[model samples]
Target: MALVETATFECGGCGTCAPSTWIDYDRLLYPVCPEYGRATGPLA
Candidate 1:
């Protein structure tokens, strides 16, 4: 089984400053922010 880990960060885009979650896997970083509304891309 593979291990999973997560981290929280602050979003400094869109002037909202919402909180974001990041998952760490295989040395890769995946960020999730509410400002992006479930999109996998960066905030506009």
Candidate 2:
């Protein structure tokens, strides 16, 4: 048997409206997380 995963992303271009904060991650850059509802998780 085989397995697959599905993910979705939505950008509202709310950079100006987005909150201003400092977040540290493994990567130098961070990913954009929209305010609106979205699905994100691991599937098996």
TM-score of each: 0.23, 0.20
What is the lDDT of every predicted structure here? 0.41, 0.34
Error of 2 at 42 (Å): 24
Deviating ranges (above 4 Å) for candidate 2: 1-5, 14-29, 32-44
Number of the top candidate by lDDT?
1
Candidate 2 local lDDT, 1-44, one digit each (tens): 88864443333343323332422222334434445323222310
Tens-digit per-residue lDDT, 1-44, candidate 1 = 99975545554444434324342222223344456533233332
